[model samples]
Target: MKITISVEQPTGDFQKKLLALLADHADDIEPDATWTKERAERLYLALPTNARRIVKEAADRGGYVSADDLRSGEDSSLRGHSAAIKRAVDRGARDGWWPATLQSPVQAQGPGFGKVVGYLIPEYLVEVFQHAANKPSRDW
Candidate 1:
């Protein structure tokens, strides 16, 4: 027997908001596509000097990229891309660009041999909460 999976595409306000966010950050680094560090640097440079400074600072502080950097260029890592997308969506939602819905945190069971007694949260939101009591952080 074979099982089929159905995919639900993002639609309505979600689609429109998602598209607008993509458009606003089109120059940013994309995942799985052929984008070089040189291109990312160029895009980063194209932004306002303040934005560039923010990216540099964030990078220096051990952040893969500043929120500004992600906004200005396409990132290759799914985590980076998701974070950037979230930032954009959050911004647009705040600005009334579209009605935003609550996206429950992504979750997963911890690796174990016996009965599942523990859970692991996504890495991103780990810093926010004291424990993994809530839903897992976003994962691609």
Candidate 2:
């Protein structure tokens, strides 16, 4: 069955919050270069509990995080609900909050598992993340 799903993009206010969060962690994200294990770990440790979970789980597996990982809480680090994370990611991608690259229906093997969609955080975003960190927070 072919189906289309629609999600509302984040509002300017929310986007600003996200940007502030990104900027706050710009040093950790190291936006100018690719993410290395060391860099990822630093960011992982630096993130708030919720974001940490998502980033750690994904970074541990080559910078790609699947919906299943988020939903099932496969990694102990994942704190937020899968649906919420999914929504935030969808909006972030659509609104250009960050530059994570997303893909759908990648193959997998396991019970209760099937093709899955995921996101990849690139080095450039890492750089932006760092730059944003230096920016002042705005009230939105």
Candidate 3:
């Protein structure tokens, strides 16, 4: 049997959920076509600097990064600029540039249970995000 989904565009939240589901269950899902570096390059050029940076860092680490990681250090680029980072991430996810989780905190075993956090992005999109960094930054 074959199934089809028809929508002009999936909403940002919907896309994020879909991507997360896919990432979490990658072993169960298979694509009809293989993902290629060319396709990755095509997608990476359109992402914002913040998104690119996050992707690059996460890719370098191990394919997953939390918001706390980005903002942990005093000299971190994301330090004191979380709002902008969130916006950039949201935009990128909305546009299907990459997959990211919602900015929310997860409770730990002890201490600071209310810490707000960022979502996790998949490592596959790292190449695209990296390519975006090489592009010149511009303002309108």
Model number with the top TM-score: 3
TM-score against native, each model: 0.24, 0.29, 0.35
- lDDT string for model 1 (93-129, tens) is 4543333442312221325443232223234433322
Please state the error at residue 130 of candidate 2 in Å. 17
Screening candidate 1 with a backbone cut-off below 3 angstroms (N, C-alpha, C), the clashing residue pairs are: 28-73, 28-74, 29-73, 29-74, 29-75, 30-74
Question: Is candidate 1 or 3 superior in lDDT?
Answer: 3
Name the runs in model 1 displaced over 4 angstroms: 1-31, 64-140
The most accurate candidate by lDDT is 3
lDDT of 2 by residue, 1-140 (tens): 33322335778998898779878966665443233333333333344555545444554555466755566544543233333445554554465443355321112223444433554544334433333233343332
Off by over 4 Å in 3: 1-34, 72-140
Candidate ordering by lDDT (highest first): 3, 2, 1
Give the Cα lDDT of each candidate. Answer: 0.37, 0.44, 0.48
lDDT of 1: 0.37
RMSD of each: 18.2, 14.9, 9.6
